[model samples]
Target chain A: MTPDERGEDSAIDVPDALAALLGADTVWTEPPDIADELVARIEQEARLQGDDQPRPAAAGRPRPWRRWAMAGAAAAAVIVGIALVVNSADDDDREPAGVEFAIVGTELAPDASGTGVVQVRPAGFAIIIEIQGLDPAVPGTFYQGWVRSDDGDLVAVGTFHAREDNGPIALWSGVDLDDYPTLTVTTQQIGAGTGSSGEQVLVARFDGS
Target chain B: MTARDEMAARFAAADPDAIRDLYVQYSGPVTTVAASILRDPQLAQDAVQQTFLNAWRGAHSFDPSRDIAPWLYAIARRAAIDIHRAEQRRRTEGGHDLDVAVTPLAFDRTWEAWEVRRALGELPDDEREIVRLAHFEGRTHSEIAALTGIALGTVKSRSHRAHKRLAHALRHLVDTENVS
Candidate 1:
């Protein structure tokens, strides 16, 4: 019988027509790593937010003028000794100037916050991130630092877990920061391989402003 | 609360697992919507990521009483369009091939395609299978009945039911398309 002859209440076969038009392959296939990478990035940001707490500044006790003079003399001697060693060493090994960025919470993560500093030396590169009030990483997940270039390419700088004892985690970035002025921290799953999770918990954009 | 409402609540709370669950459910269709526009798997994948990220960020804006699929599909479509524009600009500046042509009509088609697929997924197994065999496998109703060993009348009835439900579910999209 024709489809309409079946009855007014008969089920219409939409899938038949839809399947014919769209096909099975119309469903997009995701690479195995996409979800893991995305989740990791999200977790990284969450951990950073959970860890973002204000740390009190260190206050040194004032000393008497006589004691201060002796302390200054001792500091001067130490500085001279360090200068002499630096002058004796090869000029090619000198440390590059450090750059710092203030990382603030995005509107989605108002309580998530951190501070980032990039220290570049001729021999090596290091980024120190001080995070406060970030949630501890969920099981099997850890936080990763990402460097995004102006052209929109993202590179993983390093990964770390939040620890109760550590105030700030320092990571070595193999690449120079001049080309990658944007630093982002993301939470990533353990086996997500290499890629920014795109879950930027905290982002520090240095626009030369 | 229903599963969708619960999911919406979890998303509003910034629950990572909720976001993950949403990803597992919708990523495929979202990717399809994106890939159709961007015409690049890598860029489409990036759009999927951005879509979920935007959803997570704007979860508060979602009403739990509403259907979550359409909301996410909207976000995914917008993300794909954004990436498409960016790629277009990049290609234009670099003097590269600018063959990627997308318009509002194309986007509406993609959205309709996604909505149909999503509605099909919600159908009963028997009905879904019959429809798939008839449409996807390009089999006749009699062929589907023979292959499945179901009665011919039952096969036709299930197929008709599935079609009716889909038409009702997608009436809004169809109306919107027409209006636009």
Candidate 2:
């Protein structure tokens, strides 16, 4: 369903919503005033991670072009071809019950947004994402989406070439939403390396309700 | 340099006192942000602690000239997401269905509330009490005066002061909050 279809008015006004949050019913964790335990916990975690101060640059750190709305793994290699299945919704049978998520744009395509539905199949997970506000891919470039597992492994679910011009784009994944909780759409060139371009246009995480 | 920037400086240098002070100052709202996403109180608390730890690990990259909220927020959000994903994996391994995911509206709405909560935490204890009575308790100035034994005029004045401070602190949210 489109944003218009969703009828976005269920949310309360900001002030009223915020006021409710401050009410006694809302649970806001109050930190222990004493810092010893916090300090100890942090120190122990540091020791486990080698307590390296000024830590080395992270592979998943914010990209030079822009920071992701959330931290994520950089594209190691672009996975394309055979595994990607393009389908017209009219043809394939879909599971009655599927997990859904509100897709969000990363900085690379800040204006873009969408929703993703994942259906677990006997073969794998069949996914469909309806995207809005993104431009169509130009010649030689196509949009590819991936599902990243909790262990940082990436599977290329499917690919497409247009955004709002097309209806919902369907993709398939060999992994379930459990292990692969993140879905990322990145535009890639035909000749681009097998690794993901890392130029993420849209991303969504299906961690929990 | 401003005290905040000074704290950032010490924080970037791994000053223990500065680290502890920053945690004390911001942990409440950080936890609120985590809970807004994770929705589990215990996991939210763990996320807050992990956020601080992650901040310590990445402190060297922090720019002292800038505000620390965004940097700290990103880390807090990342920690919550990591935990959420792990929880999902754990659930699936034990046999369960996917829980309801957070909507973007909820995310936006809660961040504003979280920021306001953080600003509330920044207020002086006396002023914060007045805000709590006025907003949280739904008490009028006169009612607050009677309840807290502070004079009516004093309660009203303190309420005004606290609101002014909050408004000044949360100016960044003005445009975002005004949007429906």
Relative to the real complex, the DockQ score for model 1 comes to 0.12
Candidate 2 local lDDT, A1-209, one digit each (tens): 21112332122122444455555323335653325544644443333333222122345643221121111122211211222222223333332234456788889889998877654443455566788888877534668788898787888776666723759776766555666778989987654455799899998876432
lDDT of 2 by residue, B37-82 (tens): 7776555655675688689889889988888987898888788788
Q: Model 1, B57: alpha-carbon shift in Å?
A: 2.5
Cα error of candidate 2 at position B18, Å = 2.7
Which segments of model 1 are wrong by more than 4 Å? A1-33, A54-209, B63-67, B101-105, B142-157, B173-180
Separate DockQ for every predicted complex? 0.12, 0.13
Model 2: how far residue A120 lies from native, Å: 52
For model 2, chain A alone compared with the true chain A gives a TM-score of 0.53
Q: In candidate 2, what fraction of native interface contacts survive?
A: 0.23
Worst 10 contiguous positions by lDDT, candidate 1 chain B? B171-180
